[model samples]
Target chain A: MEWIIIPDKKPDTHVEHIYREKTDKRILKRNPWRDVRLHGTVLVLVIIAELIGTIKIPITKDVAITIMPLIYTIILGLAFYLIKPIKWIHRKQARIAEGAMMLFIGVLIAKLAISSGQSIGLIFEMGPALILQEIGHLATILVLPIALLLGFKKEAIGMTNSIGREPNVAVVVDKYGFNSPESRGVFAIFIIGTVIGTIFISFLVTFSLSFLPLHPYAFAMASGVGSASMNAAAIGPTLAAFPGMETQIEAFAGFSNLLSFCVGIYIVIFIALPLTERVYDWLEPKIGRDSIMPEKEDDNNA
Target chain B: MPDLIDSSENVSVHGIFNWILLLFIFSVITAVGNFLGYHHPIEGSLIGMAILSFITLIGVWLERYVPLDISSILYISVIGIIVAFPGMPTSEFVLKYVSQIELLAIVTVFLAYVGIGMGKSWDEFKALGWRAIVITVLVIAATYYGAAIVAHIVLVLTGVPAV
Candidate 1:
């Protein structure tokens, strides 16, 4: 007896071609590492200048403060523009252009902050400013976190979908099942594990620090360990609220950023790679079953 | 046999319940930290998150349960919220010394970017893998001590009162 099997029809040639073209375009455009490097370099320079008090351009402190961020953003934008290898003059031109744009934005933000009576200039002058004014500025610290969180959320969601061939959310849901019994069980386990780990470590660190004769600066450093933003958001406000601690607040702001970078190094080298390797190993066993090396096998046969 | 297997599976914790529990745990920790006279709110929050994570780990082995999905999202969201809300008590003071705060935050974000970017630039650093790690560690240690020294020098030069 003879058996016949019919193959399924191929997908549309045009559709396949379009997808291939799009994929190639995406591959060519992707350069997150390069962008990150440029941004990082600019950030380091800015911090060094601030610490050394060398960023003098004969502007009012408020104006200067407002302008600095603009400078950062502009430099970033210019860096993006001149990403390709260019002559020194052209690169210089791009930097100048970008700096001008950032300056405008910084000035605008500063003006807004000033108009609202939340000027950093006012905060510096140690006088009996009414209770309400002091309290109002303190409130801004709490409010800023909410804004940053919303922005980060949008960016994170967008990032999750951007990676790989398939939408990450869809892939995640399909693999883990959003509402499935198995998925729920797994999710439950993960949450419990993370929470317990977070809590215990936090307790140990906090307890140890409590016993130590730590200055406020030391406390700020401790806060900056896991995530800099959280540390800054949490400690920055407290330092501000405390009387006669403006300098400490400024110092914390400066050091927290530096500490955050150190923490990042620990996370990336020590934490991320090991976790990735374990995940890859776990997936390899299952993936290997579906993949075949027919060419190698035939070579061996010969 | 099927009934026994199903019962075993069903004995695990729920995702939503775990999130709710963790959130509660964090809140309690934060409250406790506050009561204990912890000055910084963010420090309190960190302690809360850390304690909750530890408890969750212990619960995993003892209870044989996990809370995966919701916990990750919650953790991210909480951190995100903390980062986004920048206009706290410090904003005015920070704006005054805006250069310092902005510089710090920017550098931090940059360093984080570099740490993450190193994965892509792995090939570039492969020749000096261990060296790079050591250098990075040294840089961090140096920076910590350097900042302390600089702070001390500035205080001495300016005749600022020691806290």
Candidate 2:
């Protein structure tokens, strides 16, 4: 079965219906081709960001080359709110772009993989250390029992995996079905992480490299955890850290990222998902179930 | 083409043709992006994009051969490494330009797209409730610190010289 990343469009949130309803209110009411226009508007915005991103500006010692993209994202996003013409069309397209996430994921992984072939030697040298570090990615499961202890709702277990990468989302959707109790948690974190995960990872990696005694190689490896853009963002500062060896650092990092992307799914499915269920069971018995479950999604309240 | 194409999925000729068209578009944009960046020359980015496109296609083809969901990164990277290893026809090209293109430039577009997508979904997110907020906090903290702690230990154990 093809693993779909597009959220099952709820009746209230159907993009086509939303588009049609909005169209009736506008003067372009008769235009059946408005969807194409909406896509074009967002595509133009993306091109603007792309053009601006190529220009490099030095912002302190380690933070150069990335400022433009960040600035563009903020400016364009703000413009969407301030400029009504673009904002309305932008709204229709956001869901379209979001649904096409699988395309971006494939492109990202393929783009990053070009460097993977070159990183094999570095990966072999790093050996178990890299593997062990990646295993630590599973430490995300540590939050399961803790979330339960804090009396999080049952569905909130989905956010236990940060950045809800494709694999994490797949596992949850597969196990729980579309609107399963945990689906809301997964979708919620997925949205937040997708919005913020890349920049967040970039800053965290950069800060850790500067302040901590970490081998830049390790941070390089950590950068490759599933999401291609997030991996690229995180790998940026590590490349900055290694400076002259940017190529070599990327090779190792690229290979590590490939492992995370390729293997991270199985680990989540076979290990983390099951371990989470076990932890939830263990926690409920230890702390009253009502105490652990975060407030459940009550649509009636809405 | 049997191995090359996934029959399990209901793939039509139109689908394959569409993908081919997308590959062309991706290549053109990447090349054009490079030309725009430098102003004077388009040779490097074009050459880089061409190779990248071919390598990426191979990645798509090789996807079926791998065990589990190996996807594009592994197949392309591994094949790229094998062909470009030490001294090969593609080594010089791969070595010079694989990491040369400004990845930031390309990904920035996706970032902006992602932001709008997130904004559009705010109502549904609000529906997830306050616990969603707390859960997000824990998820981010644990993912970062958990990886940090492990990386720290591994570096210490391996005696990797700290920068």
Candidate 3:
């Protein structure tokens, strides 16, 4: 029986090409300060975002999802880019800003590290829970069958193993080869995660808070899913829910995130990768489909 | 170690100076964010921002010359912890100033850059197709909740009081 309900399209390697190309010397040759328009636009966006302040939308009496300026700035900057009339930022400028983004993240890491270091006492106190929660990251492997059932082949390994951060992508490409189906899968999700994962996480944190009876500290540990922006996004709402524990919340999330960064790659390589292979072998034959073709439309519409 | 160095080939000696300049730019923006959003005074926030930038600069330097083969983030983090760890002479000064600048203030700037950088990848994102989107969301949810669930259980087993 041909499970031909869908048409299989070749995984687009163009995205992968651009990802590697951005690191070229062109990014280094240009002085970031010269991009006045990009800098000015970002400054304006930050000012506007901060001015809006934090807004908490109440889902129920005790549960409200906080929307902070961080969220607004990202959305506003993205809107600025998508708007055709502006023409303020072009591909070259966008690439420059992208290079700068890596440098800026270090500042956030510094702040979090300071918090984690200062609260070293608390970190040690909760050491067991803190260290144990890292295993939760491995839960991603459990969803392998879901991706397979959705018609993914070996790409399922990439999509299900981790959240596809830079390190995760590097691990996949290193083991599976750059143009392999596995690499393609990881890059695809990496792009999506970068684009909207922060927003989704901010909401997911509060939304889970609304119903779950688990401690805020547990959620704080979970928020450390290895990406800094997503970690901050998860921490934002957790801070809002429990007003007085900001320091501890930040410390826990920061420590958990640090642990993820330090050891998460090794876990991916040793445990998650092998588990994914075994699961793919067992499940692909059982539930995998041929492909599910979509209606032909403009890819640029988004 | 060579792989680590190769991955960061973009960062030449010239690139390091540029990064330092950009770090100052970030501190300024972050300080401005601190003033408007968090109501902290710009003077104190700027000082804090500069301190954080200094730590990051040292981390970058270590990553380049130390041959540790570790990520700069780890170096920056250890440096942060050491300066503020209890009993350290500078802990009080470091905490008092750095605490003035909220974490979200830094995040807003980071995400703003993320948004702007996103333009070049928009088409590539769109072309990733729906299955990728579904699996990506599932992966995020699974990792998030999975970690939370495990943490929750462990916290209970360890007899830690719930917050």
Candidate number achieving the greatest lDDT relative to the actual structure: 3
Residue A219's lDDT within candidate 1 is: 42
Clashing pairs in 2: A151-A292, A152-A293, A152-A294, A153-A293, A153-A294
lDDT of 2 by residue, A85-185 (tens): 65364554555444333334444554455555555565676777667766777777777766665565556467674447656776787788766667666
Ranking under lDDT, best-scoring first? 3, 2, 1
In model 2 chain A, which range of ten residues has the least summed lDDT? A23-32
Q: Evaluate candidate 1 and give its CAPRI docking class based on DockQ.
A: incorrect
Error of 2 at A2 (Å): 5.4
Error of 1 at A22 (Å): 21
Q: Lowest summed-lDDT stretch of 10 residues in model 1 chain A?
A: A157-166
Any idea how many clashes model 1 has?
Answer: 53
DockQ of model 1, rounded to 2 decimals: 0.02
lDDT tens digits by residue: candidate 2, B30-141: 4454455434245665566556667665665455445465555566667766765766676776767655565544455445545555566556655655555566655765
lDDT of 1: 0.29
Q: By the lDDT metric, which is better: model 1 or model 3?
A: 3
In model 3, how large is the Cα lDDT of residue A219? Answer: 88
lDDT score, residue B24, model 1? 41
